[model samples]
Target: MGSLWSQFSTPNPMFTEDDVAPQDSKVFRITGGYSGIGFELAKMLYRKKGRVYIAGRSDQKGQQGIKDIQHSASAEAFKPKEAKLHVLWNNVGVCQPPVGSASKQVIELQLATNCLGPFLFIRYQLLDHAH
Candidate 1:
């Protein structure tokens, strides 16, 4: 038997817009993707023809995950969308002391990356960029 990691090392599968087309009634999720339950959830959604976007905190990892999905789709004889799958995952957060970092005195890194970064991404990227 293959190691558990090896067994799960396979990337999530992707489907074409036609095969897994978004019908204007799909839901999107964020955070906790690229591993664990989140990965499985994304896989299932993709398989069901939902417009699934995997968001996280690492660009390289996010891109790699997208590649894995494409590879899986190709291997499975499906035409995955080359540009349809959008990735909102990014690490704009900064390190700060535990608890109430946004209160009183805020660490610039923590505030900018953690609080403001995501806020901007959501407002500009997700909301404004919605198609």
Candidate 2:
């Protein structure tokens, strides 16, 4: 078996502004973006003038985060065109048994939320709106 440290491997290096060209009104979607690293990442993209759409199953929390970012942007005098909601963050996560329980019956809950939801969101929402 692999060492336990492998489970906690460091993430890939962060990209600098110089490394990545600034997007022109690209839709940025993040799931589970209401809190934690996803929220912080959305904020960073917003500050960099990207349209950020943070998505969460909880509407209250998701809207709150959006308002907080908008408030911060207004305080910083960033124009709406410069920073707006474009991408939808699919940050939601869940865990279930490999096979669903006889009563609970949630075979695809985790996959649908973590995988298919984001895929469909990108394909449907972003693609439909893309120029």
Candidate 3:
């Protein structure tokens, strides 16, 4: 099927940072954005003038990520309560773990990280911020 072929095909990104228009007053939140792909995405969005917030378990790492984005984009921090979220990226996830592994709450680690955490984040946090 076309969808299946596309999955295995060489990645040809149809949209890049160049295509992103100036974001101005837009607000975005990304989980697990302190590192890896999420970090890069946060950087891109921030460069376009969007207010980017990175959320994770580690406050230290999150603060560092915010600093990194601000330094890279030469932008100032925006207050959370004043900004309505234009986008929320549930980018945090975990892969296979030890068979008996569980989250701090005793739920299965993968399920908690990939599903439950995002759900609660949206239900509790995103709702209040959504436009």
- TM-score: model 1 vs. ground truth: 0.42
Tens-place lDDT per residue, model 1, 53-119, is 6777678877776676555543232333333434444433446556655533454556756677678
Clash count for each candidate, listed in order shown: 3, 16, 0
C-alpha RMSD of candidate 1:
10.4
Query: What's the true lDDT of residue 107 in model 3?
Result: 99
In model 1, which range of ten residues has the least summed lDDT? 74-83
Off by over 4 Å in 2: 1-27, 71-89, 95-105, 128-131
The 10 consecutive residues of candidate 3 with the worst lDDT sum are 75-84
lDDT of model 2, residue 107: 39
lDDT of 2 by residue, 35-110 (tens): 8888887776777666676766689998888877776653233344423455555666666735753223443667
TM-score-sorted candidate list, best first: 3, 2, 1
